[model samples]
Target: MRQNNHMLFRINLARRKFLRQGFSLLASAGIIGCGDSATTSATTPVVIPPDTDSNDTPGTLTTTSTPQQVVIIGAGISGLIAGYELQRAGHSVTILEARERVGGRVHTLVSPFTNGQFAEAGASRIPSTHNLTLAYAQHFSLALDPFYPSTNNYFYLQDNSVSLIDAEQHINQPPWPGAVNRSNFYKIRGGMANLPLALSNALAEHINYSSPVELIQQTNDQVTVITGQDQQFIADRVLCTVPLPVLTKISFSPPLSEEKHLASNGGYDYTNSTRLYSQFSQRFWHADNLNGWGDSNWPEEIWQPTWDNGESSGIIQSYLRDVAATELDTMDVEQQIANVHSRWQHVFPELDSYLLTNHIHSWQQEVWTGSAYASPTNLQDSALSAYIGLVEGRIHFAGEHASNFHGWIQGAIASGIRAANEIHNAN
Candidate 1:
């Protein structure tokens, strides 16, 4: 179902300047009322392990106070990285997560698919342009492998007609086509989720599982955070890294300003909506020697192609938009699979026979992360600035949503580090 179903707002700018700058970027500005009219201390809080009652590793050292306490709201990649940076700088940090598991949208469900192999449900691939994540992977001794986009691609049209497609030929063409440098897509050696697991391994002590932040109240002295189970935290600084949709629902001390609300609203619009066109077990088209890329003019459900698993097998993954919208959740799994198959089977008839399993990960169905990354149209500069800006004197924000480079693991890490630095510089 549409996890955390909420409405959002739109940001309007006189012109789209970023696109003119050759980076496909946009910029704008906004203003709103100040909160509580209080001048709070900018010092950061002394952080501790999220759940210390259990035997967890002792977190990193502290620099400022006897224990420089900083409370991070989410335990996803962004939260983890924020803690890591602060700890590395000799500050105490604790991460509180809403879900039972770590890795917000970077979920990887392991199950037998073919000859005892598995596939991914959530965030799968990384691009060469993702420098921050790549650097961290290399630092952690993680192996990387290329995603095979060449082997099996097929195209399906409106009338149920199928055709073999050559992705390389259309690399620099039209209809959202960009240059393919062959090294654009890469995956972790084992699975895409391995990256987050590696990062988590580095910061074991700071994470608190199943602890969702209930309220965030900022005072002149500190920011007080209350958990769902009534656990309270008083820290000098707090990072609000929860997803935009979730953040909008949570209570803030003096209440958020109109611009901040708009930023959060626009952010929710960009982050929560998703589209999953199709999914398949094995590359049936590849067995018949066909590439697996298809094109359709559908509004949300768009393309289909082969997605590889590192262990020498893969499935055909479909791409869509708004799969997490309210209307999509009502459809049964069978109906969803059939809908995908109907769009894909005609392009590669082999899909009709070799289909062993079909699955869909409606990110919007996730309580922690409502959806995948934002679309190009959803990103704007004013929204980005407002979403990323520090609030009051105590409330700071970070996450993939609060990034210039939206929806990538690298962007998430970058935002976390930025938030950490903000805390560090404030103190």
Candidate 2:
């Protein structure tokens, strides 16, 4: 879902120019408008404890501020990491989450499919250049795999009406959208969800699932949180990690700054993305030496999420965005299936024969995340976005939206640490 800034970056450049240059983990000229992940501050390696055992050592806070009660809203990676760091720093923490399950946009689906096959609902790739993201994953001891199959022939349905197929080239575009080596791109061995699930386990007792915060009232000295259940929780400071759109759902006392309201109301822009996954009885594309990963003139990415799993039956995920995603969002699950199924048959030829089951996940439709990621549309939105991470009295904000790396996992991780530090050292 967090594919805004660093999605399948496409341009009208010549095909040769695309394959010759290769894609970079970083963005070029703000292709998706969330800036490049490479530009984010990765100087300090963020330390998020793997677990919060009762017998664990106390925090090593380096500031003069004494331990304080902290309330974190939204249990996404941002909130989870902030809670983890602050709790480790000897601060009392309470994480309020609206969702029953953890991992906001970093979702991995493993169900009904055979042989433990799964697909990511959001934030899949982990670039080698992303130090913080890589550090945290390694700190957790998770394995990594090449995101793309480098040795296989690729399919390039370069356009809809023409449906061009460049079987000779390994990949039609750069691996991502820059000059970065394709080998540098990686994914978690199991799924992207493992990272968040590990963090959630560490803070299991502190996280309140299904506890949606309805209101936030902050005075100079403290912040008061009122959940949907009418329960009141007070904290010395509050870290709000919800996306810009989700902020509108909660009532903020004294209201938010005019800049924040403008940013959320209509100034800032976020991308719309939806992923459709179809499981087939066999990996038919292999017969033609096609790795089952390609892009269409429709401007969507076709990925066999389980490509490296070496499974006979695999899942084909159509990563849709903007106009294409909007069209899919209009249809229900069945209609979404028919739409992609019809297109895949034309693109994959024999896909109709091996089709097993299908599913769809739209980021725009999520209750907690109205859009994929924050990407201010024009100069106006970008100008106003400066206020996104600005601390308001006892309340601090952090999320992919608040970070320069908008769509990348590095952004969420960095922003979480930044906000946590803001309150941890506050005098």
Candidate 3:
């Protein structure tokens, strides 16, 4: 069933008002936008009680008193955190992950570099303002280090000559349109993957890797979730933390509400992006007194992953987003690597000899997650942002996109906590 045009018009007006109000509030608070390096007050970490009983069953909970069952779709950070919280509260949780791996965007490439050095192919840096992410890291006892070292770096802007600048100068430089200056960035010691690995390990027996959710059917009381392999899980509630685009692929028995359907199908912007990590035999760029982090007119950002790792061999990563990423997707891997190499060589001619091998990770090519992250394009449609964390009866929505802090792990964790609390309070 489609929503009436009149109702949609009203909803659109309301959304525009809401966004205007939100922007006004941000302006008053001196907040420019999301994903910026605004200093956030540090928060005290909450102590989560450890699960006492061990349940080997994949979809069962072990508690003195029986609790409500929750079937979580997608084993990404949001889903995993939701499952972890629900399980801690004595609720039965069954996480369905499409890929054999757990972390959706928090991927780390381990073997490409020598001396135990690695590079994060996705979701690398953690801003200090990301309290939930830091809190989770604290809970898991994961170590964090500065993502970028305070040093001089080279910037090769739009086929321009290389210019050297200090960290402060580079950070203070004006950002591109709708972009914020990022001053503080941190990362997990091993890789961003460790965050999900810790959560997944804690829920090892309850998570079903390689199990992709195919359909969700909601009755008056019970919700039934089916996987691609025809595995069915009947639960009192289902929290869907899958990306909005991915959620569109799963059939809903009662069908999503008209507004939700529109929001899922058209409202969200699944950023077309690609990340390339190149391993080098020696730290040639570092030896040249270059931080190996720079921006180019070719529409790519380059950074060294091994800056703080204390490793001789390092990995240089190139990030291409939006149109640049779309253009890169059309080319072959060899051509893409060649192009990146050519650009870097133009800035630092020494890179030609130091480059050993390269690995590419395209979020668009990833079937489970169709994009790098979700950024809503039609903010005027209030339903788009409203339906983000909205609970449709037995089904609850969560993910980075669903949260106000979209494109960050903090958003995912915040959404998971919100979804878990909603379920916890309901039943």
The best candidate by TM-score is 2
At residue 48, candidate 2 shows an lDDT of: 32
Name the lDDT of candidate 3. Answer: 0.71
Residues 271-343 of candidate 1: C-alpha lDDT, one tens digit per residue: 4443443335544555565545556645333332224332233455555555334455578877777666676
lDDT of each: 0.57, 0.73, 0.71
lDDT of 1 at 297: 47
TM-score of model number 1: 0.74
TM-score of each: 0.74, 0.83, 0.82
| Model 3 clashing-pair count | 1
Error of 2 at 255 (Å): 0.6
Candidate 1 positional error at 140, Å: 1.3
The C-alpha RMSD of each candidate to the native structure, in angstroms, is 13.8, 9.6, 11.4
